[model samples]
Target: MKYKTFALSALALAASSAALAQSSTGSVTLYGVADANVQVLDGASSLTRVQSGGLNGSRFGLRGTEDLGSGLRAFFVLESGINLDNGSNGQNSFWGRQAYVGLATPYGKVSLGRQYGSLYNLSSDFSQFSNNSFGASTAVIGGFGGYEPVRGGDGSAATNGGPTRINNSIKFESQNYSGFSAGALWGAGEVAGDTKGNRVADIYGRYTQGGFDAMLSYVDDKANTVGLKTRTVSGAASYSFGPYKVNGGVISVNDRSIANADGEGYWLGGSYALGQHTFKTQYVESKNKGGLVDGKTQAFGVGYQYDLSKRTALYSSLTQFKNDGNGYVARAASSLPANLTSASDRDVTEFVAGIRHSF
Candidate 1:
C-alpha cells in the first residue's frame, strides 16, 4: 500500500470504521480495534498484569466522504484512542490519534491536520508485528530513551520515522502509477517567536508488484527544544511464498542534539500460516554509535496466533532484550509492564497472551 494522508484515502479511513453508510453524495463509517493481553514481566521486578493494545491500540473512529462532482471528493476523519482496561482516553484527547480533513482528486490528494507520518505508512507493511508495540518495528525503530531525541524532558516525545504522527501538518500523495506511489509532508511547529525553530518534514515512496513489496523513507525533526535536530533514513521490504512470508528493514539515525548521538538498527522476521494458525519469529539489533552515546542491544521474539474468526484471534509471544553498555537502556518491545532494567547489562524478558478484535 502507498503512504498517503489517512483522511484523504477512502481505504485508510475505512480501516478504522466500525460501520459504513452508503449514500449517493457521501458515506460515513465507524470503526475500531479492541485488543488486550495477559502479560508476565521478569526483570528487576517480576509481575503479571492485564494490559490494553497488544496487537493494536484500542480505538474508535468516524470517517466520512462526500462526492463533489468532477472526480473530486471531500473527506474527513475523527479517531479516538481508548484504554479498554480503564475506560479512559488513550492519549488524553478525544481525538488524540487523528482529526483531519482533505480533498481527493483524480490526480492525487491533499490533506491537513493531525495524521500519521509517511515513513510509518511505508515501513509498517513489511514488519512482522506491523509496528505494534510488540516485537517488530515500533520497539526497534521508534523505542524510548536517548535513541529518540528527547523533547519537553520526555524521551518518548520524539521521532524516529516521524513520531508516528504529526500535528499541524499538510500532506500530499501522488496517485499510484504502475504499482508505484510517492508522498511527502511538512509539519509546521507553530513556534511563537521562531518561524522555523521547531519543524518536522518527511518524504517516502513505495512499490508493490506480485508478491513483492518495498519502501524507502526519510524524515527530519527539528521540533524539539532549541538546537536539537534528528534525521532518520529507513527502508524495508517483504516477500511471500506459499504460506510463508519474510520481512526485514534497516534504520539509521543522526542525532545532532549532541555529539555522538547517532544510532542504527535492523530487524529480520518471518511467519508461516497453516490453516487457522500462524507461527512468527524475529530478531532486532540496535547500536549507539559515535558521539557520546555508546551501547549495543539485541532482541528476539517468537509468537503464535490462532484465528477464531475473520475479525478475532488468540495470540501469544515470548520476547527478550539484552543490553551490553551502560547507556543503552532499551531491552524489549512490549506494551506489557514486564520489561528490562535501566541498569547496564540487565536484560528484560516477558511472556504475553492476548485477544484482538476489529470491526
Candidate 2:
C-alpha cells in the first residue's frame, strides 16, 4: 500500500517542536479512507439514504515504527473510525477501530491493547468483497454474525460471531517462517472476583505461498457470571491464477447456554480483474437450530469496481437475501434503516453505489 508520509526527522536532525522531534531512527505515517455511498433497501421496509464505508470503512489513523537496533523495532497504531455520512464516530469510541503498541523481534511480535482477532483478519483477507459492512458484506451470513466492529467490554459470549476488536488484551504473533505464521491472544475478563468471569482466548495459523493462501482460527469466549460460553472455529482459503481468483470459507459457532445460538455458515466466491475493472460475485448462507430462531438465511451478491486511479475508485453492488422460518440476516447489521424490522422472516434486496478514496 502507498501512503503519504511526512518526514519529521532526518538522521538525528531535530525540529523546533518537541513533539515532532525524534532522536531515534523511525517514521510516522498518516493514512485513512473516505468512502460513502447511496443505498436503497427493499424489504419489509423500503428506504433510500447515503451511508459511509461502502467499499471500506472510513477512518483515519497514525502508525509509527521505531528501529530499536539488533533486529528489534517498536511500533504503534491508533485508528479512529469515521462516519462520513454524519461526521460522527463510526465505532462509538474515538479510537474504537484500533489502538495498540508492540515490540517486534526476530522471533515474533508482542502487543497490548485493543485490536482485531484472527477470525476477522482471515475473513477480510479471503473474502472477495473484503467483508465491508455495506453491499455484499459477509457480516450477515454467519450464525456468529460475521465480524463486529464494536466488541463487548465484558467479553460477553453473546457476540460470538467472532471477535473483531478486543479490549484489555495481550497478543503475540510469530514472524513468518517459510510461508507460515501463527498467533495467539488473550483478553482479561477484568471482573474483580472471578478471573474467568469474562475472558476470551483465541488462536490462528496462516500460510501463504505463491498464489495460494490459507488460514484457520479459533475463539473461545467465557461469561462465567451468566454461565454462558461461546466457541467458534473458522477456516478460509484463496487461490489466484492470472487475473482470476477463487475463495471460500466456513464458520461454526456453538453456545450451549443459549438456545438457537448454535449455527453454521459458509460462503464461496470468485472474482475476475480486467485492467482497471473488476467483477465479482458470491453466495453465502447460514443455518440455525432451536426455538423460534430455528431458521436459515441465504444471499446472493454481485459487484463491480472501476479503479480510476491508485487512490480513488468507483464501485457498486447488489445483494438479495432470503429468510426461511425466523432468520433475520440483512445487508448491514448495525447501520440498518430504522424502518426495517425482523417482525417475521422476509426477503430483502439491497443496492448500493459508491466512491472511495485513500490517503
lDDT of 2 at 10: 40
Model 2: lDDT to the true structure: 0.75
Q: Superposing all C-alpha atoms, what RMSD in Å does each candidate have to the true structure?
A: 9.8, 7.2
lDDT of 1: 0.73
lDDT string, candidate 2, 184-222, tens digits: 998777788876657779999999999999999988877
| Model 1 ranges with Cα > 4 A deviation | 1-22, 143-161, 335-345
- Distance from true location, Cα of 322 in model 2, Å: 0.8
Q: For candidate 2, what is the TM-score? A: 0.86
Segments of candidate 2 deviating more than 4 angstroms: 1-24, 142-162, 224-228, 327-335, 341-345
Global lDDT of each candidate: 0.73, 0.75
TM-score of each model, paired residue for residue? 0.86, 0.86
